[model samples]
Target: MPFFVYGTLRPGEHNHDLFLRARTRSEEPGRMRGLVLYEGPGYPYAVEEPGGAVSGDIVTALPETYRELLAALDELEEYAPGDPRNLYERVARDAVRADGATVVRAWVYVAAPAVAARLRAEGRPIEDGDWRGPGDSRTHRRG
Candidate 1:
């Protein structure tokens, strides 16, 4: 499955070059609905919410690197299957291509239920659901 990445994994961000540069088959602009973005330490977290949407990139990994990539990403997100202390939960969701012509099921690491609850009570959301924010120089938009 492709991954819908909205934070450090997006192009030009710190983790992109380190983890995805040569491991992906393709990467393109995409959007996932029903989620909101929250600021994390030097990163961002997507928390599920009604009427919310997030901008990101849909990354398809090369067949040869898929399993390795998945493991690496899980580690990066600090996700472990069925773990109670998880910060993020890897869930599959539908994401639309930038042109809105295609929709694909992709993996999205969203805040765990406990984390989401705490974030709802105290976290700062990126109102527009974009991690890059306006005029931020760290990332560039691409289709």
Candidate 2:
């Protein structure tokens, strides 16, 4: 299954190799529209907003690792199917590849509205949509 990631789980970010690298079949740069980025304590949250866009990676997980990968990601993101503690909701959305030509339907994790409001009140909003580069101070390199 294909999924979209714009934060710590992105390539070269904190959790990429630990969770996605080995389990993925292919990876590509892509962008998801209609989501704003908010910097969290040690990460960034994807909050939906009209006319907003998020730049990220489109990762295709190997079929055999799909279920296990999703389970691990759900745990990492604190997303239980019906749990109130769920901060991010796993969903499917269209992503445009870096080349600006291809489109793919990929799973994306979005901040629940309530959580988005909380983060909005406490964290800095990344108006640019991208969560990479110097703008993301929460990211730490792997040693």
Candidate 3:
């Protein structure tokens, strides 16, 4: 199965090493639409938006490998699977890479509506280029 990873989970980031440790493959840069990237206190989240987009990477992992990846990511995000307090959920999404090819089957961590609302109420709205991998310092503009 393919998973779409944004934030620190992207390649070359701190969490990327964990994903690599999980033995995932077929990694490639990708973008998902209908989500806005927000910068929280220490990380980023993708809030669902009708016409927004979030850039990330596409990775293919075996179903069994999801267990390890989930554990590592949940730890990093301070979230637990099936926990209501968590702000992200694994969901199927479609993504297109810079090359314009469509990846129709991928799983991505999407921000929960309640979490997004709470963040907005706290005055942290989604910002362009809010999501970045390790060594990615170039400011990304919304397209």
Q: Which numbered prediction scores highest in TM-score against the true structure?
A: 1
Cα RMSD, model 2: 3.3
lDDT scores in order: 0.92, 0.84, 0.70
* Candidate 1, residue 54: how far the Cα is off, in Å: 0.4
- Runs of candidate 2 exceeding 4 Å displacement: 134-143
User: Tens digit of lDDT per residue, candidate 3, span 1-143?
Assistant: 57777777777666678655556857888888888877765667787778888778888766777778666666666566688887787777788876877656777787776887875566354554347533544432222
lDDT per residue, candidate 2, 1-143, as tens digits? 59999988888876998998789999888999988888876777898778899888999999999999999999898888877778888888889999998999998999976898887788677877777645454553221
TM-scores of the candidates are 0.94, 0.88, 0.76
Q: Residue by residue across 17-70, what tens digits does model 1's lDDT show?
A: 989988998999999999999888778889999899999999999999999999
**What's the distance in Å from true for residue 4, model 3?**
1.0
TM-score (C-alpha, index-matched) for candidate 1: 0.94
Q: What's the residue-level lDDT of 43 in candidate 3?
A: 62
